[model samples]
Target chain A: MTTIDYRLIDSTLRDGSHAISHQYYAEDVIRIVKGLDAAGVQVIEIAHGDGLGGSSFNYGFSAVPEKELIAAACDVTDQAKIACLLLPGIGIVDDLREVGALGVKVARIATHCTEADISEQHIKAAKELGMEAIGFLMMAHMNSPEGLVEQALLMQSYGADTLYIADSAGAMTTEDVRRRVNALVSALEIPVGVHAHNNLSMAVANSIAAYEEGAVNLDGTSAGLGAGAGNCPTEILAAVSTKYGINTGVDPLKLMDLAEEIVRPMMPRQQVIDRAGLILGYAGVYGSFLLHSQRAAERYGVSQAEILLELGRRKVVGGQEDMIIDVALELARKHAEQEV
Target chain B: MRCAIIGSGNIGTDLMIKMLRSEVLELVALVGIDPQSDGLARARSLGVQGPHEGPQWVLDHASEIDMIFDATSAYVHVRHYKQYAEAGIVAVDLTPAARGPKVIAAVNLEEHLNSPNINMVTCGGQATTPMVYAVRRAIETLPYAEMVSTIASKSAGPGTRQNIDEFTKTTSQALREIGGAETSKAIIVLNPAEPPIMMRNTVFAALPEGSDHSAVIESIYAMEKTVQSYVPGYHLKNRPVIEAGPFKTPGGDVPHRAVVLLEVEGAGDYLPAYAGNLDIMTAAAMKVGEAVAASRVSEARL
Candidate 1:
């Protein structure tokens, strides 16, 4: 009800980087950005390799430099809203501010739910610069309706232009999405969006659920190239949105073109979605990218469930690959020992 | 006796699967407020436990189990902690909501688990706290403990999103708990960048004047670097040995460019990043281990 424009943010460059290593030979990125823009995608986000702050490679896996990625994104100026994803503590106050300075119109600053207090300063800064700031409450996996409301009110206080309820696990079902998004909209004066994963193949359905419940913004990656059973495929959302007359501004056919053209051949070798990432969709884990765990599985020689368990045991936050592998390896060793 | 795991979420399923494979813990029931929780279905399919629809179902079978592992989210943990405690049923909270003793297997964990509510800190806290204590004690000359930051790859899971804020706060709490230093801050970074990121923490403990410079630096670096194997790079920031750690690319999609630069601002000098990380993580993991063991064994709840 708050944001009737119904903006669709294509995080392929941002969150999709979770799958592509934030590197796509430079040209592939240009193509994807151009294609998505031409397809009427609103935001073509450019995110750093995972572990934006600690090391150029926090996961101890990715190698693209943030500087280079930002530089690459700078090239795509006209087609779409150039955005960057900033994890408050990971990217320094200066780093994010620099991102804002770099002509990025939108800054998606993410923090854990209830940490909206911590995310406040960043959101304020992004606002001061006249940039649209989104307070993303990643992994909105909560059992209590009160906690959900608490997170929304917190996000609202930060003066964020938008608050995204990210189902990083793809855990929430359709009705569940309606309830969660509705709760956030009810709590905050700002607009709320839904980012879903298709682990349980409900990314399309859930995104709509959020829309029907008063959410205006929808986030997805091309071909749903994301973590933990993948994200809601962008083409599907664009198509479904238009059919419902939501005016997402996304050209469904072009979105599909980007998926087939840019995503198909250029993608990395990934682990298949584990049962848990899938169930979390139904069970609702609200994952950002399933590809992260897949890589963990293949590298560690364990199942996706095992990788998820290892991630849980380590309290490995989403997007922390280095710890995920270490946990997976350790867990696999434990399983091996048990076998003996 | 079998242990029931309520809330078959990530941690719940993990505990269930791990318990199923262990001779020490037997699985009996997996309960959730939502029946769709995959872990419940998983437990049932694996014949690992009885997947129940909710707490009411689980309460009925509580008498049949010896222990209950609340692997659900913190809200659920908080809601049921008293019930489990009052039922005379030992409960191990995998989530971060318990009010009882926070157990780190390697820390001051001996008699605390005897208290009904046992809290397990995040993986980062488990992997980093011991080193915080070690560095503080070893370099008794340091002042203003500054946790420059923690950078890790994505793929860790929802528990993090649900608790990253609590994670940072809880981590600093543990650091102070073990290190006895009031000046502590935690910086958590989640990498969604391509080539997924690994977890790395670099502590900047500005050493006291006239302290043994090189030895303190190297030892702390050594300690920190050792734990990088545990997945999270618990090391001295920007040091020599950092290159030596066996960090990885999550499977193959993500690259492993985890370079932590640890600059110890103004005291005498900052230790190398690698060395500092090693010391902190090794110490933290050890502390967690100590806490876990004591909590489990002393309480006789394990």
Candidate 2:
């Protein structure tokens, strides 16, 4: 086994935003950031679930402004750099300028796998502001390895420091992770990262595969508190890394305390591979759409799994939560008509 | 009327095929910067004048063209729009440059057809704005409207990918301008599904308390007919869904809101049937171009 030097990016504040319906208070940020920083996590992303400027009625508005949340995170973090995700359409270049002024150190400009070219301006803006720009090709399971590498090349050319394969759906298997990560690692000079969801309970296994295939950065949230079945749990990941004799620069014991004592107790809902989550992984639907799908399903009196399946059939990505309600409504109407 | 297409991308090439079937308009030239672009290659094979010099090609054959479809990127459309305006050419812009008044064929095409330059907004705008306009026409006021358009990832060309920010901005602004929404937000999704799916749009609008639900649904169906007149593939996947009581929106709480779902299948012009996003733009442009052509022909006859 090749030795891996991996870095953990704790996203309890970013992906975790989805679990909380984008209601992360400043106090939540301060505690989480401080805890993760002390536990030796190198990067912590803070923003709305969908990214900065994603606070709207359409995609649950954050209780507090993201800038304020970032400021709170910045105040607490002494070692870990503050990072934020920025989707091109949902979060524009102006959001980057605001985050840069808030002392954000890293900017992850994300786009749909085939839409990486949309991230060009945001990546350039992040680099111009002297931030470590990371290119995030979200919904990695949606694309082939070769197709992903081509998109990653666009981000690299636009000045991304690192490229991440974000299995936003938690859909990839270990082999899927290895193939894409290895291909991207070989094709691009920049380091590759993995952001896996635990929908199919494969987030940890996928992360390990990514590390084995030369991915240097991996994202996790304490207690797997994130969208869908949550993300790779930081404490579990650190413990697993120790088992593999890998140096992740994170203390397993400290991470366990953060996950068990700090994060899990405050979770709105325990992260589990429920029917909807399993369907998210199985159907390759984006995990971030989990809550919205659930809410829509309930509103339309349809099964959440059915909603996920329909959304997956439609190949809906992030920023398409509106599709969930639409699909649910249509399904409910069809059911009514069929009953008649 | 003799018309040229200024960009030979997915949208431009599709527009070229539609124009080739036009009853009134003559497709004069297909222009692009890439000599090897598939659009220009296809245009050449179809016996259309395919030139790679873009606006310069139109300028070289200035007398032969009366109107031009600017299907290039937003930044490129800005330059092409100015050049076309100077040469007294009517330009239909498919980019989100938003340099001219926005026109949706089902809503305000007649009002803006006489303008020298007309902006088609974005595909999302073309797909959702008409529904919002229909709601507004029925209720007379839409406090808030949010639109999300999901298209196949393979259907979005590089130009579409690069213009993501502009698309949201332009589409949302057009919702307010043409759709009569007091507050509007727009989102786009590029789905990377294999055997790519058709284009789908969701429009959410907050209505006044105890509004006429049947009247609004009737209005929406009527608007769907108008759009179908130009875009044969546009249809409602289901009847409009209405929800009651204190709905939360960015614009604030509303007592009632109507949810509309629309899907557009392509005409299978240049791209496949999954590329309805591109087809809608070409179809709307053709509608405007045909109007321009009819008016020009009548003037020449007189």
Candidate 3:
């Protein structure tokens, strides 16, 4: 068997915020950051569920401003590098500069799979600020391998230190992961990574497939605590990597302790492959949209499944939360027509 | 009543189609820098003069054209507006240049008809501002509003893609200035779906606590009627969805809020029916153009 070498990036404080409606207090940040750091994780990302400046009624508001959380995490962490995600329009360049000042070492500049052009200014700004810039092509399943490569090239051109194929919906199968990652690994001059969701219950397997296919960076959160069915559970991925003899430098036992004793208990709700979660993966809707869709479904008296399916049919992506209400309302209207 | 379209891209072409179907106006020229543009080609096939030289063609043929619809881009519209204004012609801008008073046909079209140049804030602004204005008219004390516009990726032309920042800025400004909110923000999403989706807008307004939901809903439905009179494809996807606040506003927490969902279907003029973003602009512009043409005829008769 080939010797495996990869990096485990913990997102318990970032993507995990979605599962809790982005209500991450400073204490939660410090505890999660200190735990992940001591576990020998290479990188820890902390931000609102939708990234920096993503605190509004549109996306849920963070309990405290992200800067305070970032500062708390930075102050506690000594081993792992601190990072954050920035989804261009939602988080401006000034937000990036502010986080960098708060000791964020890496800036993951993200955009929709086809909209990589919009990330240019943010990525360039991060680089100019002397930060390691990672380009995140979200909703990776939306584009073909060739299309992904073309968009990745645009990011690589703009000085992205690494490019991540972020499966925002957790919809890709292991084979799908391998194909897209292999294509990006071959096409990109920089290292390639994968940020997988567990909506389809494939996050760990898909992350493993991506690693085998040449993705050097893999992302996960504690107890699979994230959007939809949550992310690749960091502890489980660590254990699985050990079984495969991959050296992620992350302590599986510590991750397990953190996931069980600390993370799981704090979760507002358990992350499970419930009907709506599975439908998010099946329909290829965004993971962050799960809670919003559920609330909208309740508000409009429509099935969350119907909302997810229609959203998937429309290809509604991240940053299009408003489309959920539109979908739910349409379903309700159609139901009303039938009743009449 | 003689008019010209000043861009040959998706919007300009669609506008040309609407112009061709206009009863009160004559389309004298289709103007664009690209000689081989499909819009200009369509213009030539229909025996309307197609000019590759752009606004100068409209200038050279100034006597034949009374109005010019600038649909090129925000940056290009800057120069087109200046030239058209200097040439003593009426300019209707479809870009987010915001060089003149932003006009929503349903809310304040007649007010800007006499202005030398009128700016259509953006497709999102057009679809959203009317609802915001209606809410403001009903509540009269709205402090915050935010709009989210989702359009089909296929329908967004190069101009729309490049002007996204301006789209947000222009639309947000209109949401506050013309929509009459104390503060506002805008978001635009281009969905890459096969069998493209129609244009959709969500307008969120935070009214003071204990505001009358029925009054705001009634005003919004009435405003929808006004917009649909000219842009027939415009309609509410559902009745207004109102939620009591504890909602977040830029200023602080607010009391009650109203959320309006609007969908726009195209008239299948030059693009597909899903291209309502383009259709709404053209349809609204035609309504304004007809008003302008009527006034010109009245003056001529006088």
How do all models score by TM-score? 0.56, 0.92, 0.89
Give residue B156's lDDT in candidate 3 (0 to 100).
85
Best by TM-score: 2
Candidate 2, residue A92: Cα displacement in angstroms equals 2.1
**Chain B superposition TM-score per model:** 0.68, 0.96, 0.96
lDDT of each: 0.60, 0.88, 0.87
Error of 3 at B47 (Å): 2.6
lDDT of 1 by residue, A1-340 (tens): 2333578888776666656655545666778878887887778777653424423233323355554666667677566888777776555456666766677788887765545555766777788888888888776764344676786677677778888877776666687787788777888889888888777777889888888888988988888776656777889888887788777766799889889877867777442455666644544333533454566577657876666654553443454443444555566677788999
Instruction: Please identify model 2 stretches exceeding 4 Å from their true place.
Output: A1-4, A56-58, A242-245, A251-254, B208-210, B244-247, B293-302
Could you tell me the lDDT of residue B204 within candidate 1?
Answer: 36
Which regions of candidate 3 fall more than 4 Å away from where they truly are? A1-4, A37-42, A67-82, A88-105, A115-132, A300-302, A330-340, B1-3, B23-28, B54-67, B78-90, B112-116, B289-302
Error of 1 at A71 (Å): 3.4
Q: Per-residue alpha-carbon lDDT of model 2 for A1-340, expressed as tens digits?
A: 4443987898999999999988778877887887899988999999998998787656876778889999888877898999999988788888899989988999998898888877888899999999999999998998899999999999999999999989999999999999999899999999999999999999999998899999999999999999888999999999999999898887789888888888888888899988888988999888888888887877889988888888888767778887777788878888999999
| Descending-TM-score candidate ranking | 2, 3, 1
DockQ of 1: 0.08
**B183-219: candidate 3 lDDT, tens digit per residue:** 8878777777777889988898888876788999999
